[model samples]
Target: MQDTTQSDPNQQASTTPITGGEPRYKNILVIEDEHFIGELYMRALTKAGYNVKIIIDGPSGLKEAQTNAYDIILLDLMIPNMTGMELLKKLRDPNSTPNLKSKIIITTNLEQADEAKDEIEKQADGYIVKAEVTPKQLVRFLQSLER
Candidate 1:
């Protein structure tokens, strides 16, 4: 067999592509179970011109979601209690958050495309698999909410 692929120095990566959009969120809520990833996202989103708040557990995240108003929420489906899916359902309820209007984005390590699609259909603005996305990608995702 012979090598036949073109070598382009400026070739783009095949990683997750971030879609750009307007500045919709001034404040964002990040609900992640993993402390490291939560911190990582907090730093990235903050640097992206969006104020962000981090919650490590699901219940606390739910409480915060109910009490405070944010432009968007970065949620993780797996948590100790009050799972992200439940959080999403609560957020979608008209009575759960009468004054809430934050767009929810599911962020997890799940590789299942069906799960991501299900979340989108359930009201998540977007989905990002943590292990599969970069910091810049997360930041750009925050930017996407602005649209």
Candidate 2:
């Protein structure tokens, strides 16, 4: 099995101020089927002083999301077991589970039509096209959410 825990070496060098007096480590969950993309996110987010966990499939990712409180969730539209949209709906449904407060961001390469894009925009906190943003940009975006 591939080791899932990966962190960037320059994380300590980050200039972003740790919230409060001490560093507040935010928890992040990444639901992406692509190993390369997952690794890239893990490294960048970790470098930005966040604790991140990665799940490659939707079912497992959904379970994890339901059971734990994450500061952010990076979800891909396509994956094994269930689609990202399905998982997002479940997570957002208050009756479906308890403690589903994570901010979900759709991160995908899939191009959506106008209607689909509008629906996704309504459901998710943010939508990021994978090709448009680099790992650093992702981290910076997440930081903006802290304010």
Query: What's the CA RMSD for each of the models?
Result: 11.7, 8.9
Ten contiguous residues minimizing lDDT sum, candidate 1? 13-22
Q: Pick the candidate with the highest TM-score.
A: 2
The C-alpha TM-scores of every prediction are 0.77, 0.82
- Per-candidate Cα lDDT values, in order, are 0.77, 0.84
TM-score of 1: 0.77
> Clash totals for all models, in order?
2, 0
lDDT of 2 by residue, 23-54 (tens): 24389999999999999999988777788999
lDDT for model 2 comes to 0.84
Q: What is the lDDT of residue 86 in candidate 1?
A: 81
In model 1, where do residues sit more than 4 Å from their true spots? 1-24, 113-116
